[model samples]
Target: MVETGNRYMDNVSKLISWGHWFSFINILFALVIATRYLVAADWPPSLLGQGYMLVSWLGHFSFLGFAFYLLLIFPISFLVPNEKAMRLIAVFIATVGTTTLLLDTQSFTLFNFHLNPLVWNYLFGGEGPQATNLLFIAIPFIFLLQLTASGLIWRNLKTLHQKKLGPVIATSLFVAFLLTHTIHIWADASYYRPITMQKANFPLSYPMTAKTFLIRHGWMQQNEQEKSNRHTHPGREIKYPLRAIEVNQPQPKMNVLLVMIDALRADMLNPTNMPALSQFAGSASTFNHHFSGSNHARLGIFTTFYGLPSQYWPDISDAYTPPILMTQLQQAGYQFGLFSGQGFLQPEHMQTSFNSIEQLNMAEPISPVYDGDTQAVKQWQQWLNQQNNNGAPWFSYLYLNTPTGMEVPPEFDGPHQPTSTMLQAQQAGPESLIKGLFNDYQNAVLFTDQQLNRVFTTLAQLSALENTIVIVTSAHGQEFDDTGNNNWGHQSNYAWAQTQVPLVIHWPGKTPIQVDKDTSHLDIVPTLMQGLFETTTASRYYTSGLNLFGPLKRDFILLGDEENYVVYQADRITEFTPKGNAYVLDRNYHELENAEPDIQVLMKVLNELRRFYPNN
Candidate 1:
């Protein structure tokens, strides 16, 4: 019996020894991860010059990694006495941790963001099949690597007696790290500024709760004041499903057709490529210096419908806030129809806003882009024909994804082709093949123009043009390395090349007025309400825009995506980036090194943001 007891003790001793060694290896792995994060941050020289800031970030990451490993892996490894069970548990934990790291790396490469709930949904919820497939392919490799490491840990076993010293030391250090990190967060939050630099140091370090606490306690100034104002006002809960607006006059009984083309740059409107749209612009109210509410389709379309900035999207979408414009039109007895070439839910989760849409033409080109556009337009025409004699005011929304793919029929293909060298340079380096890419995009635009001609011709044939109000625009503009910064797509930046778009409104019996002043997508819903319904009541419910018929009331326009915001004024532009850096630029987008941030303008914008999204 004594010998049996001795044998059991020997086995446990071996297991504990293996556990400690493996735990130490995890600490080393944590160090490697911290190093990788620093490299990925790519901090600017200005930021690096802040000696205390640099030291704080480094110390924070190092302590975070050490604490996490000691608190988690060390406890598990040391406590499990059975050798086989310990190995299994350790391998499982390692696999999960490694997988998370891989996903974070991929997300940063693609979107300059870490993995979050929204991005996770996009990955697993049937969007970007090619990218998802590639991720799955790489998973097996990650698992194999994890398994090899686990094997090494198992093989390098040693005999060791049970001890409490290591656990006590590790636990104390973990507590100290936690206290230090919390204090750092509290100190940063009290300053009334975003903790952007801390966020960049490690993923998911936003200090959200700490900031809220500071604001609530009056420790912060700028944002705290704005937040206090929101709750103090009577009936400040933003009314949605907007109070059924009472039109003072009988609404104009006209067929409304809104065509939103994708990625059609303002400069692409030319006689050769977009002849139809250019000609249409002549007899329509053209907003020549118009900008989108955002540089991406999700926010752009939301802004047009909601008449608000993209920052309000989460509130309206998550709560299923039916667009006031749509609800008002519905109350006025208008039937709605929607046709989209791309699946409305992909890339942006727009289905959250337009919840009642049942049928969608979510087909893409199997060969040529024109073929797909042709089919979508024909389907729209058929749908329009069915509504011809209903005698009810009708609203149709057509979203074309033709130019989004930058493909065209052979006959419409332009003369430029990217050379092999140019393609290689673009893929490997920062050089852009702009000429070739623009040619392809423009050819696609030409094909889209032909499709537009077909729609108008069909409307004329059906006698719908006599009373229909046709409004034409694009969701956002495309980029072609315009800044020589290798930005070749929309939604990647808030530059003018990506945000500026064309807006042409055609109301029956209305004079064509070309307005060259700056305008924005926020002006759309209010303009339609005033022009078509002659109703101004919806403006009372926190609408961020004024009717286009009035003089420009705002001296500046706001633009943004998920990660950054920009304020564009007459002579200059101010950009607020995710890493807490502010950039000032000239009208032409050239950086002004000596320009100071316009704090008043920034504060005004931030106040509006807090007013709209108090809880975010």
Candidate 2:
């Protein structure tokens, strides 16, 4: 009787052990699938995800300290393979992870997943069952898997302990996964790399969002008072909208919203390269004679923001300039917000004017550079809704950095590559490859344009479309296959590719005025004023840039490395690429041969930049 009773107890223990072991195995397997789907959705790219990594990294280091403490307690290289022990670890992980999911709901700013459910408020936010239902099913299944795995571990404890170190190895792996976020906080790297890169919005939004949140919650009260005060003609204190101030007219404020597509060039504005984008642009004012400011992103940013002339601030860093566009809008009773793809706090280019700047960084801390910007946009809209009662018009800037910032050329994953694909078409030669690269650029451009369609759609849905003025322009065109110096992107000038770009303006409820002459980003700030205020045209009154609504002073646009110190300009008929200090001064950029007058103007702009940026 004693022997039979012991046998029954032993069998019961084995079954319980198997149940826990299988449960764990199932959970671990489920983890792999969760990671896979997250990757497939390209989740990080749309989240504007960044800061999660820095926090995660800090968590990893903490775990490491805990692991060493555990080593001291056990002294045996492994924990005893008791099913109870494995079950304890499994329960620990699932409990912490699920609790995190529940606690994720807070102020919208804190809702990174946007799955916050305000069960208490009828009008609070949450849509469809996407993230919520996913977690709902995932958590239970994960628990079941963990339970089974724990049971399996129990049945073979004694012999398995003699041979294998699976528990230690598994724990170590979990620790390693924890540490990856540290790298994310500091730099850009993905664990499942080459798979997708856009990291979280650490450097991009940490301080910016914190600051904006405080300000949004009335911390800006001190600054808000400054906004209400205006200086007089002699810098005397005056009330805003002074009664004695001269008035041309009281015009309806057209809430202008500008979307600057960074690193975008013109040639890609088409059907084959960018079909969806092409369709979007077809409805707006398209200008054939648009050129970018300076070479690329940094330089282009300064010119468009301040209209200080690319001659003054080249990279928007380490140099000082006068008041800029965003500030001017604030002076005129407008609220300015920016949503960008570049790290908002680094590289110095983005540190300039704005009331608030959203994430505009990455999807996760360890994700790629061009990934998270779009999520910043979604957050921007949510924020707008919350602040709708602020009683002032708003100017929001959404700058996308995709297709343009990919480390490699664009990729098309539908129906495979068509017969005319760049790969097949450019097999001819290096020049052909260059052409293919150009083709790639255009395809990315199209991708960018298609995304804008979403932006417009969202704006219209919110009743914010007609009350806004939208301007679309690129920072600079890119040089491919070293047509200039074997370089493959936006930092230099080559022909018809780098300096020349496209520009468009679509004012809500206003007529689209097309121009035949030429315009560059320098004209942006002033032209923006043109759209809002009916008085002083951008170029004629306060700014040096020629107004699109006024006379055209430039026929051929200027191009330079720093400032076109050594000048180059092509006439309407010339066709030759210039060496050394180069410029395209001819008509349609056919090429120019030693044109003197145009070259002189180029030299003047160069000298002007030097005068302003003397210390730089």
Candidate 3:
């Protein structure tokens, strides 16, 4: 009878030890969740059969890590505990985690289809948050049950002569993972992409590890975030200081006219047929290496106009503030007008910033249709004439979308065997019916350039040419390769062809300063401000923008597509640099990428931002 009792006690002791380690494993998974949430600012929802949503999109990545960790460490959780019970615990932890992921995903989908108006709308027909009620209940049981079981088992092991290394390693990883899961429960959490940021300064951690990260990464070297911004804004309070100093450049009140020819490439302009743009490029400060924020018109327009890079805000279409240049110019009594053929319906966010928004008011397509040069020339001349009616000098923002149509690839390249979804859609457009569609598309671009010529001619005719600073650029660049790598459309891929854009600044009063260095579309705002206010500007006080007219040359241009992020180094234009290397593109701005090159960081952030803003 005494021998039987000893065996029973041994079984309990072993069971307790096993539970403790298993609990730690569960905690490790939790840490992964926390870390992702800290970086992403939320959990991932499952996708397809799994959970996935904007805020929770990073979970897909976390899921990969979790699976790896599980496969490697899970078997050990049962080394000392009941094998059947340990398996059940594993199932419980996984099931609950999976549930959380899926619930988050479902929330995003429902929010997108039901709450968003930008897409062909769908209604919320599911149980909504109520559908995941079971997950909330299961999560705690799985988490707490393991936590309690772990503590009891740890006490039992101490009583016996038990080796704790296996338990220690397993439990340590588990706890770290669990804590990581909860890292962002606090407000004002900032995420750092170790590779993309010039300084690999990650923000916030628990007592034992926080200082270590800051010290190790040399976070103090260039702590831009710690610098006080406090710019002397005209009407608003910003972070960057633009006050208590005067610059010799033109005042902020200078009548500045910015024209964005959608999808205009650097080589797209020819001086002979499109002499006006060529004149601007020749006479003005030409940025032969200017790149756009995104390859899409929506992201391009917002970034170039607002003086904020597209990577900062995922949902560009919803950001409504006027481009700092326009806002400052307006404060200085400049009239603003935005003319587009597609109507502001696409970049609907334009309404909040643009003073006058006019589309292609058509009873019928004008004889030349879409991007008609003669009609554009006539209209621009008339609009240029109208600027004088209001005693205010004008700051015109013209966005022309004539050559904006997509073209079918003559070949195939991409994820599948050529789904060609977008190309097929483009084939249905009017360009498809036209002979030599690509040639016609090129002609449309030439015509658009010609129309811009009319604006220049009218400016000269009105004698407004000498007084104005004309900026000729494009929102995004387009593509036509049927290559397998085609992400389809602008800004979708991280390739140079998608983001490279034309930048020409013709300041009549200044001597030629050829800016052949790499520059971003965001610099347009600060550069214009330098010409106008002759001062600095930032979102708060520490705006990262460099003065467009400054002598600084950038070695890298940080590029982001909703799913991918990369720092395209200017000096190494022909090749990719070692990841994590900091490089400057133009004066005043530098970019950082991680040691491990993963462009997906930008893509994930973009997807999340899209999910958050407008809940779309």
lDDT winner: 1
- lDDT score, candidate 2, position 390: 72
**Lowest summed-lDDT stretch of 10 residues in model 1?**
229-238
C-alpha lDDT values of all predictions: 0.66, 0.48, 0.49
Over 4 Å off, model 2: 1-252, 314-322, 353-366, 387-391, 407-443, 481-487, 535-542, 565-616
Which of 2 and 3 is ahead in TM-score?
A: 3
Estimate candidate 2's RMSD in Å: 24.2
State model 1's lDDT. 0.66
TM-score: which candidate is best? Answer: 1
Candidate number with the higher lDDT (1 or 3)? 1
What overall lDDT, based on C-alpha atoms, would model 3 receive against the true structure?
0.49
Better candidate number, 1 or 2, judged by lDDT: 1
Q: RMSD of each candidate? A: 18.5, 24.2, 16.8
Cα RMSD for candidate 3?
A: 16.8
Ten-residue region with minimum lDDT total, candidate 3: 228-237
Deviating ranges (above 4 Å) for candidate 1: 1-246, 249-252, 347-350, 358-368, 411-433, 538-542, 578-580, 613-616
Give the alpha carbon lDDT tens digit for every residue of 1-616 in model 3. Answer: 0124565455545554554454445545555444433333222121211121222323223344456335633444535345455545555555565445434433334321111221111112232345445546666666665556555555655553255476466454445444433432210112222111111111122212243455466753223421211111111112212333333543344577777777776667666435568776777788777888777776677666665545444322222334445555545655655554444544334333352333323233333234333444465567778876665677665667666653212331222222234445556553343323445456556656657867877777778867788888887776554233534446555455667877888787888677767788767766666667765333223133467777655445555543334456533321122222222232212123323222233233334334322212
Of 2 and 3, which scores higher on lDDT?
3
Question: Residues 1-616, candidate 1, lDDT per residue (tens digit)?
Answer: 0124665566555655555555555555544655555555434223322333344444454454455546765576556767777677766676676567656655554434577654465556665336655766766775676566666866644221234455674665456446445645554553312223344556655433466776677777755543342223111123443445666645568879989888888887767778898887777788888988998888888888877777667445534566767766776777777766554554233444455444543454334546656777887899889889788888898778778888876565454466324476667433344555676687778888889998888888998978888988888999987876767789777778888998888888888898888898988888887778787476645467777767787868888865576889988888876543578997667898888666567656755554553331
- Each candidate structure's TM-score, on Cα atoms with residue i matched to residue i, is 0.61, 0.50, 0.55
- Residue 334 local lDDT, model 2: 68
Candidates by lDDT, descending order: 1, 3, 2
